[model samples]
Target: MALPPNSETERGVYLRNVFYNTHPTEVFSTWPKLIVEDYAVVGRLINLYSFIEINLRRLVESWTDADLLPKGRIKDLPLGRVEELAQTVLLWPEANLFALKKMAELRSLRNLVAHFGMMRFPDDDAFLFIAKSEADYKKQTGEQSVEDVMLIAVLDGPALPRLVQELEGMAQWLATVTAQILKQKADAEADVSKS
Candidate 1:
């Protein structure tokens, strides 16, 4: 039986079609696959840190006792720019900027793999350049000649678990700093009010 089309249903189907059309086509070649895998690792790294970022934001949004603001490695910028929210970044005291720069290179390479092959995305040359640069970025950053990136995977059963554990440490350290900053701000305000 023929039926009349609902406007909402028609819109939903149209949106799906657009999304499928915009998605990048996968490259069957081996090099592209490796690059995509590397990109997945990069996402894991971001995922590992995301927890800390979210926690810090939640702390402020939840507005628990001022103690969570102190003693923790978080920077609470309360009441400054309600829109800014200001407590997104949390990093350990000795976080390695050098490693981050290298990782950025890897991510850029992966972007090419996902968006470029025979479509409106990244290109092969871009991926190779990222791989090559990642290999040598350590030297440029004045490190101990790092020829590879050590990704700490999420799933257990191998060395990846340990690496992921270490990465979490960095996030925790950042949280601690944030707490200190919040405490410092509190103390300063208390002093001002005393006058």
Candidate 2:
């Protein structure tokens, strides 16, 4: 069911970020390479990215599951159902759409790199970049040599760090969303009892 206007999902974003201990810089510095150098850093990176990948897939699946409920069924939704969903997915559309979409794209990049040889890499393995979308490629500049991809080869690309930051932020959002959704279900049940 849809959330009420006053729910926590409506928390001011600044406040929400503060509440979540989620300054992007804080999360970024905690990232693999930014935090360290060498194989250990790479290992930490793989772990972080793997965490994000598995959970993101879980998130989409949970959303699809929650999406299956008929409208107005929050009251009818079994207790803890939303919690189950939120445990695996983000509850917000805006953040999930942008951040998770990019992360999934990053995962696809990793997949291609791992499965294919280093020769397939655009320039070198030194950085990772990607096309925003196939349509982005289709829209070329009038006569210039336009490329649809946004390359992260530039200094401080934020591609890897951004993914880590988003994963952490979304993880935080999942908790709040779970609580809010559960509360909504409980409130709905109370309303039904009163009527």
Candidate 3:
């Protein structure tokens, strides 16, 4: 039996069809299979985000007081918020501007991946990460054209692994800088006590 045009399944099928310029049934049949087959790519994307988020959380926690902001609270902070707090508090002299910038870029890319959908054209094999709805795209980026979203990264491309490596490197850099700052603070406190 065919579902009525007003049925929930029919509504879901065609809601975003205008933007893709494709029949709803094509998307309905292909999207699930594409997503499932690309499960490993999804895992890599998630892991890449986690490496940066976890490190940023740790850096923020190291400086924030447990009484004012509990460890669990810090852990739960959004990636962008944690990045902002880490930037404000961690003032070591050896901080790398490039790495910090890269971390910010990673946060933006992670947001896009989390909020948008990945799609590939019938003729093209490269799945693009893009906002499916025009309204949502405009709301997120304040741009009228969904085309402005840009081809930032591919789902299964070499860029994903490279980003993972870069994030790991940044995590190491942050850990070293945090340790040095803590040591300096402790040493200064000890000196003051002895004097």
Residue-pair clashes per candidate: 15, 0, 0
| Predicted candidate 1, C-alpha RMSD | 18.9
Residue 120 miss distance in model 1 (angstroms): 30
User: CA RMSD for every model?
Assistant: 18.9, 15.5, 10.8
Instruction: Let me know the TM-score candidate 2 reaches against the reference structure.
Output: 0.33
Tens-digit lDDT track for model 3 on 50-132? 76666666557756542324446676776667777766554535447667766776665556556656564344444445445
- The candidate that wins on lDDT is 3
Ranking by TM-score: 3, 2, 1
Candidate 1's clash total is 15
Could you give the candidate ranking by lDDT, starting with the highest?
3, 2, 1
lDDT of each: 0.39, 0.40, 0.56
Model 1 whole-model lDDT (C-alpha atoms): 0.39
Per-candidate TM-scores read 0.30, 0.33, 0.54
